[model samples]
Target chain A: MSLIPSHERPDGDPLRPIQRFCEVVTYCATLGIYAYGVDGPKVCLALPYCEDILGDADRQWINTGAITTLIDSACGSAILHALPQYEAIATLDLRVDYLRPAPAGGEMRCWAWCHRITSNVAFAQSEVYVEGIDEPVATSSASFMRLKPQKREAG
Target chain B: MIEPGHLKAEAALPPPEQFCRRIPHLQHLGMRYLPACVENHSAPVFILGFQDRLVGNTHLPALHGGAVASFMENSALLHLLMEQNGTSRLPKLIDFNIDYLRSAGPRDSFACCEVAKLGSRVVLVHIRCWQRHFDRPAALARAHYLWEPVSGNTELAEDIRP
Candidate 1:
């Protein structure tokens, strides 16, 4: 993965919550872990390379485990980024399908759309791609729980 | 202290050879297979409580994500190995999902899984990786398997005993 995104940010800018989230995701992705990201409209996240996520005994490409984590993290990050906006969506369920094996040594870009935001729940779908491509590597759909953030009683 | 139900035994372990047959990939990883409780129904589930090999970095390096995924996949595949108690066979994975709660510390872990549904064409499996200290879990997974049943093998209802 490239550090281009990090370098683009001007120095001494106090990090935003969303930016922090991106760093967490990037940290994991760079080390071959799965974590959340900054891009929305299609919420972005990264799935890093690791020997354990490979299926072929040969360890040539990513496997089902990596794909599974990417979809889950993408959906999770999307909900988190939009949490202040949609107060009621709980994650009811999520499903993902891998079109083919994603190559190792690169990060996955997950772009998700909030298809529907309802009174008590939100629905969304996402596509995962590598190195900015039109054909998706994987796709997913998710449902989130909706509830008002907890309030503290007056002392 | 470990919970009474969680502690593992030494005997009755399912050999890793069972996985090598089909995936042939796991064998190359050189992971040791420790036995789960015998009551788990000849399940292929095994545990590799924390070992130094799993640590990735110093100063509280979270358990490697790749390691976490490996444990999850191994737990799911154990169901196929369990099917052959006395023989050897490899089962094909149909589908699987995982919900990660937190990053694992550099400690031992317990891996367990089972076949929830078995049919002529497909089987469903649920797998989990529980940390030694944590109360909730490091991660949880569910997987589906496509079975190529051995001829002359009898079909039976899946036991939820484990």
Candidate 2:
């Protein structure tokens, strides 16, 4: 019983709204967060580092914040794989360890897995890498609090 | 009342008013400075309000998690820059750990930072984000920055040497 048809391959593009939300609200569209799909047990999303929008003051290196944002989006999207309903889930905590600064303007990709889920909490972990690069730039773990449905406001 | 060293440390620092102007990303997010008050005096309080483009979940009309995280990171970075006073190039990010206490509402959000430790080579800062009530924090973060002192700073070399 999938809450979100989009997450299940049988339902046809359940992650569409998530992708759109990433593009618009999160400013992740600038990071190129479009490519994604369910791969075996994990969900994968990939995008190149956008130097024009994601770079730092000198524009010489990728800002750590950009990498964090990418990891958050990927992790959230991965959580949606398990609970893909339209209702929003809030992130409770996020921890990212930067092993090394990512190469400036390199192609970055991420794979996320929903490791555990309970009645009200969900835990996810992910790893980010620069495309074709042997070393991963960062690793992240995040917890999401599933919120109860709220009363809708009238238009 | 402020401590003499605190005041002197602060005097060595840049005014909070100029922070938004100095960092491009903060400018991009439209973060603004708020004056000190009784509750928060450790550092200048900065704010990022609700905006259409900042919304990640249209259904819930909520802010993106990454944007909130980035805002918090910048908040800590701003505090670091103030303490460093051009002692180093932009501090390199070593790590970022964030805890979201609540679902940030669609309203103005404020951030305050506290420097846990300011060593010669590294600095650690704690930041909290709140809206409407400072008692209720929407998110909290601890960030570590690698401070690479710029060359020719005889002052810094001497301080670290002995």
The TM-score leader among the candidates is 2
Tell me the TM-score of each prediction against the true structure. 0.59, 0.77
Supply DockQ values for each candidate. Answer: 0.12, 0.40
**Tens-digit lDDT string for candidate 2 (B25-115):** 5656666654344234656676676776666666667777888888888777776776656446677788899998877768777787888
Cα lDDT tens digits, model 1, A82-126, are: 655424233455566656556665667776667765556667788
Taking candidate 1, what TM-score does its chain B reach relative to the real chain B? Answer: 0.68
Question: Which regions of candidate 2 fall more than 4 Å away from where they truly are?
Answer: A1-26, A29-32, A84-87, A149-155, B1-23, B35-42, B152-162
- Winner by lDDT: 2
Taking the tens digit of each residue's C-alpha lDDT, what string does model 1 give over B1-162? 235254554443434563554454354333445454345434444555555444432335555444565567766665456554524234455555656566577666666666676665666777767765435677776766655555555443233212
Q: Output the worst ten-in-a-row residue range by lDDT, candidate 2 chain B.
A: B1-10
Query: Chain B vs. true chain B: TM-score for each candidate?
Result: 0.68, 0.78
Of candidate 1 chain B, the 10-residue stretch with the lowest lDDT total is B153-162
Q: Can you tell me the CAPRI class of model 1?
A: incorrect
- Please give the CA lDDT of all the candidate structures: 0.55, 0.69
- The number of clashing residue pairs in each candidate reads 20, 1
